[model samples]
Target: MACENMKRVQKEAINNWRDHLKRKLTGQSVGTKDWLSSIKQQQDFSRDDSIPPLTAPDGSVVTSHRGKAQVLAAHFSSKMTVPDPEREPPTVPVLTKASLGNITITTEEVLQQLQQAPAAGIASWGKRWQVTLAPDKIQAILISRRQDAVNWDQHAILLEGRKIHLQESVNILGVEFDSGLTYTSHVRKVAKDAAWKLSCIRLVAHLLDAQGFGTLYKSQVRYLMEYSPSHGPPAPVIPPPP
Candidate 1:
């Protein structure tokens, strides 16, 4: 009789445990630990990208016909420092008309010309090393024309929200004399109120030249002149190009 009673008690206890588990799984507020442990476990899996490269038995270092596979592996391993989602990129500074230091050109006049007649602005002011203005919403320059004699094509880098788009065809004097002049495909756009002034475009251009991209790509211009909000349009170029 005692054994039978013990069996019944065991069955009841098992049933109660199942019910408790069901409640917890359904989020019915049964006592449990914080959800952070699960989240942390997921994050750990996402961050880990460690891998080892193959080494030859001779230990003198191996090089393949396609270059060193181990070298490429090591490079990728070094880049594992930044995870896919853990790191956030550094913020970019705003640009303003006042930031255009030492540039005496009338920005208001340029802005007006861009709004009224886009083609005229490029023809009159979009020369080599000229600080041209454009709508903030425009990011990349759309090359409507290209010169046949020039070795380069039209493609200007955009500063995103900072610069006005001079999508109209314009020439960029190469960093080196041998590089020759190339037409800008499109200009990169930037924020009107960037943290780094647009006036620094020349310096940036030099850096890009050092990286060899300048020869292949157009460097963005920095408008360092101060921009008076009251003097010109106030709207932040919203509704960026689709």
Candidate 2:
């Protein structure tokens, strides 16, 4: 008799679940709102009197609920340590300008990358995962930490008897890099560019509310710097002039 009762209960449960799903699909039910509310209210779940077996701190397994709770409480309490007023401050490394190695390797495998010609205009992409490199558009930049500046306009690198002129800086994917690798030139250019964009946005600032203006700024002016490969100091938000 008990086995038959169990089977009946399971069948009723399955039917009710099917009905609930059908109602939800047909838009007759309250949808996920009802489910979400149940979660927030902590309802519909059956009570669980059992807890997982826990190991005690003293190397023995704790089985009792009260003992488990006490062990957990002790474990949690140990995590919070009072800070000593006289404790010496921890040491941290000083921040300095990053250095890059100057490698002059032109292996046979990557010889095409080293090839450059007297270039004109550039810079593309697709999921087809293809790239076309024009030798004339390839620009070369030499990164160095030397204090003295080189007259790059007069220097050129040779590849397969073709003269490849050296540039003081190279612009790759919207980020500019100079020979020094200090990003000083990149910062200067970003500031100048951002200033012009800020001025353009300022003209229509009066027309937009705070939220609207912010959205516009993020989409256009702010993201211009945000999406860059490396970021410089943030450009100040110039207030709209009265």
Candidate 3:
């Protein structure tokens, strides 16, 4: 009874979805405002990637390209620490064997500075080094056992004053990882993408010879399915090409 109810509900939902698409896409209703609006949205997506004019910090709308650039420049410049002119070294001597001297930097000073000012602390070592940590492009994942239902959402990992919240799964280079190390997300995604490619190739299968079809299958479809081949559910056994 439960399975029958589920099947009925699913059928109704699918029919409703099809009806919605039909109204939006086919017959006289295609002339409706919703259809036009949908087409316009698609056009906006396919084209028009131009950035809109930005408002400057000083209550001015920068319409020109050059003004917009200056606005962006000022915005990014505020994030950086200003260099002190007074701290400039007075020495003019170039490095040579005679200029080489013993290290003046103490280990304790380094440790103290690291602890005290983690965001901004630079006692020059052998050479000047710049902080390359971007405000964006940082991700973190937490891995744990499936039975462990402990929620650590309250805690956060901080680096360079930025909060990096933990994720159950994080994708890196198209591969997904989760807490349990099952890699279910990555395998499913790869499988779906491979299936789509195979279906597309199947449309034109009759045009290609067996050898050509095999080549395309090996290069495009098979390669995607074979990626990270050791993991997840195995692909179904398909009969050899006749």
Give the candidate number with the greatest lDDT: 3
User: What is the Cα-based lDDT of residue 194 in candidate 1?
Assistant: 41
Count clashes in each candidate, considering only residues at least 3 apart in sequence or on different chains: 51, 0, 0
lDDT of 3 by residue, 1-242 (tens): 99999999999987876665555465321223445555545444322324456888889876666787889898888778577857977887776657556778654554454345432332222125654665456556655443354455554445655565767788776678787877888888888878898998999999999877876775666656544443433332233332
Q: What residue pairs clash in candidate 3, if any at all? A: none
Judging by lDDT, tell me the better candidate of 2 and 3. Answer: 3
lDDT of 1 by residue, 59-97 (tens): 554434233565566667878765567678888886665
Candidate 3 error regions (>4 Å): 1-131, 146-150, 172-174, 228-242
Per-residue lDDT tens digits of candidate 2, residues 1-242? 99999999999987876665444444422224443443433433323424555798679987667888998899888678666868888997868778667876434423334343223222223213455655776678756554365354455456434566767888887677787776788888777777888998999999999977875675556645654454443333333322
Candidate 3: lDDT of 10?
100
Better of 1 and 2 by TM-score: 2
TM value for model 1: 0.17
TM-scores, all candidates, are 0.17, 0.38, 0.38
